[model samples]
Target: MQVALFTILSSLTGGHVRILETAYRYPRRPTFLIPRNYYVKLLNMLDTYYEGRFRDFIENNTVELPPMEITHFYAYPKYIYDAMNRIKGDLSYFDLFYVPHEHIGMMMLLKGVGVKWTALLQLTPVIGALDVDLPMNPIRLMSLNLRLNGMGYIGDKLFEYLIAKAVLSGETVLSVSKSIPYEMRLMGLRARVKVLDPGIGIDEACFSCGDKDIDLVFFGRLRREKGVFDFIRVLNVLRRRMRMRPRALIMGASDDETPRLVKARLRELGLSGLVDVKVNLTRRELLSNLARARVFVYPTRLDSIGLVVIEALAHGIPVITYDIPAMRLNYRTRAVLRVPFRDINSMALVTAKLLSDEEYREGLANEGLRFVRRFDWVNVALREWEELGKIASEESKAPETKVANVIKAISIA
Candidate 1:
């Protein structure tokens, strides 16, 4: 069985890309379709982090697939439509088309082409846009509009429409965490979802016990949705209220102006001496730096699996994060301490306790080390590969029938 993978590649690194890179190491390598321009960027990333695994894939598989240009987020549906139309005749060569993420554009493309496809629902923008937990005030509404380019309402509705259409189209949906399916159902969208066990993984080297001098560390993308501002607020509370001068590290890639905004906020809050910010470190560099951090403070509201959280656990670091659905569902261990969402005071108090009590901190760190062993990358990747093979095998049994039914269902929707 042959499978084609459609994914978005970017310069900014994340858990989604890490999952794809791991899957590429399986015995059955799927043909990857990404934007033509980012091919070299991907190659460079692989060479830097994976020890030239991309070259190994070519040498072992003896296949160099042509690149596809479909990176524009809003215009991707049209781009994929045109690209698939041009290669409609060649689409029959593969048994299945697999998408790493549940991209609405890819759903539209697959519907138009009448193909058997599966998408991993990492996280949906619909949940972020319409979070009832977050009050919808004027400032929040304006921020949403700015992020969605002044079409916040339309974009939310469109996401709902495409997601419903995809579900009705009979495409298999896999979720990285149970929170996503719950969110979808809360939004009144019934989807048949399979939750992947240990949905995210970390390198074996991430497990270590060493001299941890850094008091706090926050990793992942430097964005507001990731609770970067909340991180700062917690720091402010720590200094002013608790009178603790804890050393903090903010390490991640900057996809927008958030880094500059973060710097400005740091200056304003007088945290320039307490906090150090680093951006765009390679995987190896991140792990090296992460090993020295005593506690991981992630206030993220945007992550589905919180891969960095797992990495922190793997590194024997106790974590304090927001009590979001994803965190409550996945990381419910003694190793991870949870505080109320947006509760800076509570987060600060927890951080201070963890820092002051070395015995308690070490206990949590030991628990974290024990819990993270099950999330080995090889095991997670193998399970996903088996699922994909099952998907492909089922499709190959009656390709024409499945394709026709999908197309019919999509048309009716």
Candidate 2:
């Protein structure tokens, strides 16, 4: 049963990364994104607010499969069909249980299974925590950009609230950020929240593209928030201050508004000739570009924490980013110097100091390689799995006990 859950979550789930039928992530990276739409802003909003109020039903409501001994793969027609066909069994088989709000299908699937004692893992803030204040997601108004199309916009706060109700009620909630847990409480979920941020997956084994190292690399939507403008600013700074390790900025961008602006900024800065921008590169190629950079510039927002930072560190390059929770958590092993986010002068100063100092760059690299160690997919995978295991096992004890046990397990993990 445990194997089935792992296999299903590991494969066929949403996101840019997908595990193959063999249960090994297609490329072997330890991470995966939830299935998505271009409305990244809206998605971020829904992840937190669309609280699955029904989710915390793991204890007496259902049965569970132990961590090691379950098998059977079925990519049935859909969640509703699959639930009707497979999940109609007794609760005793599963001593513990879980439910990760992996997809709309899975969300609907739980209602039909007539099962209980399940914990569902979720990523993002918008979905379940609708009541929390969040900046408006611009993506909701995206269609307004296309001139000819009559199609208007998507995303509404009212709709977000409805989604949150389905997500927040989970018997146990698992998220990738510390903020998720905090948000859960602000919304009145007095207990039962866990944060198992899947740090950079074991990248070397998965993203190892013929070992050639380059000068610099950057990835993400080409937007100001990600600091591509800052990257350009620092490039100019390098021209003025840092001489050694002359850079060739290889930027990989996702299809988003940010990249278009980034390109425009690069042109405005007159570094168009200096920086090589690739808007859409295959995964292998993206890694290949990363392999080339000696150091990666990730001068993003102070609050933002994405898994990309860890992926870069895993590639043996130190990062120069604004000090934030994401980088702070990986402080010891990752090569990074947290600076004030968006301050061009500080960014430039740090860029000059670090890039010009070869000894420091090397130190940063060594430290980064070490820092990302704790996040190795294999190293942290079991701990995450066990967190779910304990939640499932202990939830059967009692509601207050269930919440207390799961929270304790998370602290230990």
Candidate 3:
């Protein structure tokens, strides 16, 4: 069966991109429909980062598919809408379409055209709102509304509407973490959702128990929702109140104004000297740097399954993150120290204790290394392929029979 995968490969560094890349590596490869300039952008990134290892990395990470049939299109909603109209009839040639959460508009368009597709929910706006610590004041509430609505091409209300419709419409919905389905129910929307394991491969080279010079590190997108500011605040507390001069590293990529905002926040907090900001490093460079850190400080409330957390665990570093639903549900072990949500002071204290106590830190790191072995890329890819094959098998059955079989499968699961 043929599959069409829709996503915007804007950056090579995020969890969604990792998932997309893993999908592309599957034996039964899917035809990817991405932004027109993505190929050139990828080439530029490979040349900048991989340098001599470019060919080796490409051959190792990706599989050989049929000759690519490139179709250029912008990522804007209007452009995608126009393009979909032109290609609606052609979409029937494929047995299934796989759309990521970022492209809900494309999923809606595909549904409108009566095509068979699956919705992969990475992170929903409702979950983001629930995880964040916004005040109930009108102004703060309004600001939250604006931020959620501005997160993607569509407004928050429209996004929720589409999500509800996708769930109630009997489409195969896949989530990366159990927290997603739990949060959706909290929002009063319920459906049969399949939760996928965190699909990220940690290179054998990444698992290093070498010298740990850096005290703390935060690696992810530099966004408020991901707790970049919270990370800075934690650093502020660590230095000022805790009286510890910790060498910290902030490594991430951003397409928005978050880098400027992060810089200003660091200066305002008087943390400019203690914290180093590195942007857009390759995976190899990132893990190489991460190996020097004693602790991974991830204050994010936005990730469904924080892939960076898994990476840190693979690198034999203990994680200290916010006690969000996703973290609690997935990492209930001592490998992760979860502070109360938005408690910067407590987070700082924990960081100090972890950094000071080598035996304790090593214990947690060992647990983390043991726990992370289950997240192999080959196993993740196989599970996803099996799920997709099940979905594709139901295509020829009657609608009622398909629904019953899906319900039965969910029950068995």
Candidate 4:
């Protein structure tokens, strides 16, 4: 079965791209659609996965796929219209289209275009607010309310579109979080929904237990949403209350200007000397840093699935994060400690306690290691591929031809 993967909006640091990269091991090659410049950089980043016959790419917005050849297209609903046009005006050649829930516009459009596709759900903040009916943290609730109010008319149309798509598309829905399937159904979704947690590769040999000298560590995008600044504030409070020069490490990829902003904030908080910041480290470098850290702190205000949290757990590092609904619903385990949203004092206290209490920290670390076993990338790839095989078998009539190349449009925002 020939399959194509296209994401209209691609992020160098995003989880969706990483998931696609992991799925590259499947027997049938899948083409990627992304920007040409990013394609090279992304290939270099995935050097470990390069096996000579890597999937091909088509520069962004180029409708190059032959409608008579490819069987199915697994799309992340960023640029659906362009992709549909790429099929040489033959939607039937693409038997199944996979859509992420966040792309409500694309979902609605596909239904109108009379195409076959599945909805891939990632319970983001908007869905959490609309579906789960949980008491959100004050800040997150406020932000959600503001966004909803701001998008009043457009939001209504989008949901109407999703409901229509749900009724029209008799395809299955794939979700990463357990709560998403239930939420989608609650919203009158008619399609079958399956929960498949996207997994990460784990090699115990790659990750090591190093000296726990680093008191606190946070990795991933150095953006405000990831709680980069909030973490710095928490460190300041922890230093004052504990009255010790606690060491902190902050690492991840960021825009050219973000590093300057972060440094300015660090200096303003008098944390420049106490905190060490780095960006764009390779996989080994990131894991190495994770191994050295005693505690992993992620104060992200919003996240569908915190992969970094699991990575920290795999390294047997205790984590402290905000009590967001997604984290509480999906991974509320004894393995990671949670503080109320925006409560820097509580976050600081927990970090200090973990640093002081070795036994308690180790206990949580052990539990984390056990909890993370379920997220092994092998299990993820198998389940995902199994579903793909079933779909391909049903569409065996699809003609065999050279897979389409990838085109990436959006850059880092």
Candidate 5:
């Protein structure tokens, strides 16, 4: 059976593309739908799919349409609609259209074009809360939801409406964590849902038990929601308690005002000389550095799952993160040092204790390495490929009108 993997993103920066890169390993040989001018150079640079049995169908010149950047929200649906309309062959030639992330616009357009589709749902912070990270005010949150589900409104930007459309159009809905699917059901999604945990590429031998040169390491996007400010506070507490400079490494995307704010905070805290801030490191570089790091600190507030935490575990590095639901879902064993959310002092104390106690840290590292060995990327790809086959066969004859009606009922709830 033929399938198409669609991504509206310009590059494979997050777990969304990591899933695609791993799924390409199976024998399905799905065709990838990428923007003609987007992610071309990045795909070549990544080189994970070079030897895979997959084909690329770049969306270009499908119709006489105006140019739009791949980063734009509306550009993807427009490009996909034109591509499906202008294809030389029959639409039935492709059995399924699989999107690794929630692209409501793309799903709606694909449904209109009579293509069966599946979507992978990972809870996004802003939309998952449906209140734009508002303060703890129940009245305000309920009022916002009321406006979102009100009548005479086009279902474009509302999370409930967009997700309802995607769920209605999708033949299957795969969630990375169990909590995400539960949350969707609460939001009125009645589609067939499955839990598929994300996998890592690291092996047991990936860890070297090396020099442990870096004292503390944090790897992810340097955004405010990632608890970058909180990380800085933890570092300050650690330094004051230890009475010395604590070496830390931060490697991730430094877009927007993050870099400026990080540097400013570092200067304000007098930590500019102790911290090493790097951006856009290759996977190999990240793993290499991780191997020599002592502790992995993930203070994120919005990640569905901390893949970097798993990577650190694979490298025999103990992790210190918040007791977020996503982390609890990801970690099955006593592998991580979980502290209360946003409690900088608790985090600092745990980090300091882990640093001081060598035997305890190594024990957690050993347990983590054993636990993560089961989640190899190949195993994950194989399971997803099997599920995809099942979805393709089982839902081949499913009626679109039935799913649409279900969504219509849910959207009004």
Candidate 6:
């Protein structure tokens, strides 16, 4: 079986492709299939996908892809949304050849080139799959029922309409969240789904990689939806509760109104004195910061999975995130506690519990360390390869590398 880790021209896709390539050791190195034109077209298309939701971001951000020939619509997300949208909605866009067709072409290319089966790494954001813009219960209701019986017939009518309309979104194989794979059956898609946890690559060897003896650290973008303002609130609560102020680091770049809103909120909350916000750092710099922190806090309302969470867990630091599926699905936190999504009080309460209970917090840190080790990119990568093998009817032919052996080898040698 041959595998391809895919990405659009955006940071979301680009980052994922890099993770799979660098972390997973395929029996033989797989080719990095990229075509800038496809991404260009995708950005151009997203410029119009969801009533300007994605399109707005495309126009606002400077989408700089690596100098590589990324595949055509294969990496384009809007193509998938549009095809599925037009078909499900049975919109007039059937006049245009679209997403599924795009997936078919890409898949055909792989097959035509003598590749048995190809793996597509699809990055599923919490906001997108679960619709984070709306209230949780409402969104959850939509997602929950969207996973039921008639939805397949409903989804299929859309899928068939899109395929018939010639809007072929190139998505032959789906690399999605664990739940979405099951949900797709309800939607009546025949394609196979491989649910792999998505986390940024974590290196365990460096002393600074997972070392946790510092005050506090927060890596990832500074955005409003990420609950940066709420973090400030939590900080304020901490100061009042502990009487000792904790120094915090905020690292990453932002493109939306979130940066401005978050900054304004910090000043409003009088948190400028406690927080040092930095934009953009090298991977090493980010890891170094993680190693120095006692805890990592991200109370986001929308994140399918935060790479920073795993990064923190790897360094043996506890994390505090809004309770959500992405976090629950991706990592088991010994040191992480979740509050309800967007609940500032609950966020502070749970976080304070960890910070106050030295023994409990330390125990969690140990659990987090063990948890992240299971989700090493090597394991995820190999698992994805196995999924492709199953699709190719070569599951038995694939070699099994014992997890225990691999773990000892990485930790020791």
What are the Cα lDDT values of the candidates? Answer: 0.71, 0.47, 0.68, 0.61, 0.64, 0.50
lDDT order of candidates, top first: 1, 3, 5, 4, 6, 2
Candidate 6 lDDT tens digits, 248-315: 77776555666666667768867778877766454455566768787778876545556667677777
- 1 or 6, which is superior by TM-score? 1
Candidate 1 C-alpha lDDT tens digits along 1-413: 67777765555356556556566656677777665555566677678765665556633432223455543443555566655666678789888887777566666556556577777777743444222234354344434533532234544455445444444344467777877776565444555677888787776778765678899999888877788888999999999988999999998877578888999999999999999999877777888889999999998867677888988998889999887777877887999999976788999999999999999999999999889888877777777787877776654223344434544464445
Model 3 agreement with the true structure over 1-413: per-residue lDDT tens digits: 78777665445655555655467557776666655455446556666755533334333433222222333211233444555555667667788877756344455445544567776777643334346434464334434544642444224354444344443455666777777776666555455678877645655666776678889998988877778888898899888887889999998877788888888888988889998899878767787889889999998867767888888998889999987777887787899999988789999989999989999999999999899888777777777777776776665422344333433342344
lDDT score at residue 296, model 3, on the 0-100 scale? 90
Candidate closer to the true structure by TM-score (higher is better), 4 or 5:
5
RMSD of 5: 6.1
Model 5 agreement with the true structure over 199-293: per-residue lDDT tens digits: 34544346566788898888877876666777888999888776757689877765477878888889998998889887766656666777888
Q: What TM-score should be assigned to candidate 2?
A: 0.60
lDDT of 2: 0.47
Candidate 1 has its poorest 10 consecutive residues by lDDT at 125-134
RMSD of each: 4.8, 12.3, 7.3, 7.8, 6.1, 13.8
Model 3 CA deviation exceeding 4 Å by range? 50-81, 85-90, 125-129, 132-163, 166-168, 396-413
Winner by lDDT: 1
Two-way lDDT contest, 3 vs 6, winner = 3
TM-score of each: 0.85, 0.60, 0.81, 0.75, 0.81, 0.62
Q: After superposition, how far is residue 284 of candidate 2 from its true place, in Å?
A: 3.2
Taking the tens digit of each residue's C-alpha lDDT, what string does model 2 give over 1-413?
A: 23223213322112223122112321222222122222233233223322322123212222232222122111211423333344445334444333444332243233333334344434333332221222334332222211112222333333433333443455465555565465444434333566765522554543443343455566655555555666777777776555433555546545557666766777886667777778655445666677767767777642224556766767767777765444554354536777764566786677666666878887877676766666655544555566655655552323233333433343344
What is the C-alpha local distance difference test score of candidate 4? Answer: 0.61
Q: Best candidate, TM-score-wise?
A: 1
